[model samples]
Target: MDIKEYIVIAIAINAGKTILGIYNSDVDLKLDQSPLTLADRKSHYIIKNKISQTKLPILSKEGRKVSYQHRRIWSKYWLVDPLDGTKEFIKKNGEFTVNIALIENSKPVMGVVYSPVLDILYVGAEELSAFRIKQASELLKYLTLINDWRNYAESLPLLSTINIFRIVVSRSHLTKETLEFINSIRDQHSEIELISKGSSLKLCLIAEGYADIYPRFAPTMEWDTATGHAIINATEGKVCQADENNKESLLNPKFIAGAFNVDEKRINNHGR
Candidate 1:
């Protein structure tokens, strides 16, 4: 099996399953006021332990804080968010995901995202493009199923003739800037559909062609978007920084992500 299909995909699945195991644990607030749980720690350790076999440095949101000075020198590393959407997980909404990405030269070359509750997996790489698998939770213990899974997996940007202009936004984080962005989109497209999703699923919707665009004007860390960005790129889509000035920062600038064949004029005008 390919590394992305076997290692990255498996690691995400394992971490996601571990998270689901502790789904009902008590939730505490971090210094940033984000929810934290035993599941987050368990998933982080599980991914850290397994992915260490690759011998590449790891940058995980849940892991130790690696100084930018230390991280700047590494040409290649594994970027992980062991448990994304802590709020959604706490809400039992099943929109949380385990995100893993391979970064080289400051760009994501490969990625895997697994949603434990939904039992879906999305994987992508420069070489392999992108794919989405249903019932991916069942592949956790069965390595032999990799080939079968790949065969059955749906290629990303699945729809070729979508009519309505769909915009996906964070369920828990609808900011004033986001609303303004939506209103701007409404001015351009007569038929607009708004989708409320949690976590990286917003990006996944664009990758799978379920949504046309995802405008994230709220704050988000690099790890939160890295996996989804890679998948979208694999499908010939864009995850562009809203501000070109902050392109070098570790914290992602406000951004807009869109599916392949989306109106470039829309993105070019708004994703500045």
Candidate 2:
């Protein structure tokens, strides 16, 4: 399907999440060991079915189990993380999001992140462009574009002589390796502040220049960060290799760095 059509589907599915998330408060809560809720299931179903119409095989967190044997053969496909922040959803923290990404040759080319509670949609493509759309008051009016959004981004001051950096960590899952990595940074940087956030919004904070770096040392599947990774890349930011020992093994499967003030060429090299 075309980009506009995909966006429409994303917004529609996000609206469904808003309805269900609100409704779920009155119903009995079923908390899985890993924070699964009815709203997550509902959103996942809506997005999965809607994207299925595009005729592309989907590898989704809530959909059918397709083996990598089949997935490895496809040139292009969809990667989805419907209801990304299930813990945040259950907590009513309003930080959860729905993520949809198009992966071409194991790299994300396009992505859409919709936060139902916030009524914000961030869309982008590696070849095309990126934009943030906010929902209008009139139900039929659709999304109103925010003009000169890049100007707002450029207005932010750059990092100069700061010895310490702000680091964003996962709220639900914290690992010892992640802590050790943070401590390692703390040894060099004077003061390290750890901010806890859920879902892809962590990447947004870095893209918006609120945070300096975000490192995920634990295991994370591709769909979990694809959309946010795309956004970080588009915003002239670098999600680079953290390993100091091996430069070639730059793209850390263990960690990701969202340095917003960095150059695009540097970030592009990280992608390689």
Candidate 3:
């Protein structure tokens, strides 16, 4: 059995369910001043327990800290954000997700991002390509049909696209640089739409071809972008540093994600 078809998908879905079960729990502040809730812990442990069977080391947002020196030695491992977009989850906006990715040699190779509230599941890998499953809560009921995932699962970056140049940005973390980047795009295109979204959905939008570009100039850890980066990578999209020549780091640098190449001028010129 494929690990993605069984273990990965099952764990994401179950974790999403666990998150929803305790939706209305109290929120606490983490050391970083970010919000934490019961759902985050519940989902983290659920994924931790299941993924542990894989025997690969895990680097999770909520798990015990693993230093970079130790992590640098790992050629491959699981990267997870059990509850992405806690703010959205708290707002009950149905825009949050549970993110999991496989990192090989510091690059994401496979990924799964599930939005439990929306019953949407997205899975992508070098071997399996990329797929978006709607009403994904019912996925378990048809486990045998996974080999034929293409029959029901929608392949990413859907064919139909709007004429408008859409730019998806984080609802909470739109930095001044991001706004200037959007303005730069507007300068070139007469019709431009700015989209406000939370969590990894911004990258997912690019993978789905709903948005033409996403400029992230704000702060984000590796776990925050790895899953989405894998999905974008699987779709033949590019997620790279603004300079385009700089290598990716643990804390991702200012970057642009898009299905097509974004002009280097726009990336380097923004809010610098």
Order the candidates by lDDT, highest first. Answer: 1, 3, 2
Residue-level lDDT of model 1, residues 81-168, one tens digit each, is: 8888987876678889999988888788888899888889998889888999888877555647556777868999797576888889
Q: Could you tell me the TM-score of candidate 3?
A: 0.88
Please list the C-alpha lDDT of all candidates, in the order they appear: 0.81, 0.62, 0.79
Flag regions of model 2 displaced more than 4 Å. 1-24, 28-36, 136-140, 143-164, 241-252, 262-272
Which RMSD does model 2 reach against the true structure?
6.0
Off by over 4 Å in 3: 24-36, 242-249, 260-272
Instruction: For candidate 3, list the clashing residue pairs, or say none.
Output: 157-208
State which candidate has the highest lDDT: 1
Clashing pairs in 2: none
TM-score versus the correct structure, for each prediction: 0.90, 0.75, 0.88
True lDDT of residue 19, candidate 3: 83
| Cα lDDT tens digits for candidate 2, 1-272 | 25543544445455445544554565433444233555556766777667766787677777636665556677777777877877776666777778887777766667777777776666666654555655522322543343333332232223446545677888888888778766765665578778899888787667656677777776666667877776666666667643321112213376556666645453343232
